[model samples]
Target: ALPDAIEEVSQADQDAFNQDGLGYLADKARTLDALPSDAWEPDLAAFDALIASLAIEGMPETGLMQGSWLWVGQRALGSDAPTPVLDPPAYEIAFGEGDVQVRADCKRADGTYAADGGMTGALSLTLNPTTMQICSEDSQADAFLTALSQVDRFAIAPGAHTMQLFLPDGSVMSFAQAE
Candidate 1:
């Protein structure tokens, strides 16, 4: 359950959102002498429908799910709270590939340039029916990549590839197939 303060604030915000009805009242008030009273109902109805459709329970939001998970000790009445243990997080992104191969490096949460999120190196994957291998680098691209061939192998479906690089630290760096 959400906190009481959060719930109250959300309710107040929703009430405010509904009360103004897409700022029609303010817009009309600005042009009070310009437009007649009959030009309001249809616009109001459209705004109401938009608000109703945006309800969380009524509709589900779709996107990549990402967040950090942490473990913290409960605060004691007479003792100082323990420091929070920050567990590493996995960020999943999907992109297109011409062949049955996709490769990406584990980046920081901001996804700027690549930093070692403790994967082997850059993550490379090839997906064919019942065969999947997550390699550190592209063997076909360079002789050096082929030399570092300590690949972690797995099985996956053939048509499209979704790669997950499981770090030694028990978190996953995954990329879902991009649409």
Candidate 2:
């Protein structure tokens, strides 16, 4: 005859059964059931390509304007009609050894600029546009392009990460390095 009460199962045996048997099976079942037949799936190839492109886009180039910069605001001399650029357009400037390039959301200006006089407080820049493309009707772009043409002096903040370009009208254009 069978015993009325069976011996108590050892704690080690119970733990092993829970981890290696039931737990393993439960995990496997969950993994298989996690995705439904109608569930949407991402295209890994495209995802990987997008990630690669973003990485490349974030990389800083080699030169003075090697890193990416964004427009913060502008301070004019007398009036502030262009009030603090609350939602400033997506504008950027990249400087190289002897070139300055600008990219606004709807426009682009690429030309040669000289910064040699910057050291002696004779800072000056000239944007002789070789190419100008207008993609959209952007007033901020217009303002920036106009300001770029008028900028004659520039100052790099003590940190060297922030920059200010002074226009002939005493207006100042501010920029900060991108993360």
Q: Which candidate achieves the best lDDT against the true structure? A: 2
Superposed model 2: Cα runs more than 4 Å off: 1-66, 79-82, 86-89, 117-120, 128-138
Cα error, candidate 2, residue 30 (Å)? 75
Question: What is the per-residue lDDT of model 2 for residues 64-173, given as tens digits with 9 covering 90 to 100?
Answer: 45465677788766544435654444788877766777776667777776663322222445666524656465347778778878876666666567777777556778
Candidate 2 weakest ten by summed lDDT: 116-125
Residue pairs clashing, model 1:
none
lDDT of 1 by residue, 1-179 (tens): 22477556567656665665334323433464355534665565576467556657632121111221111111222233422212212222322222222121222111211222122223333332222444344222222122112223211223323334332222332233433
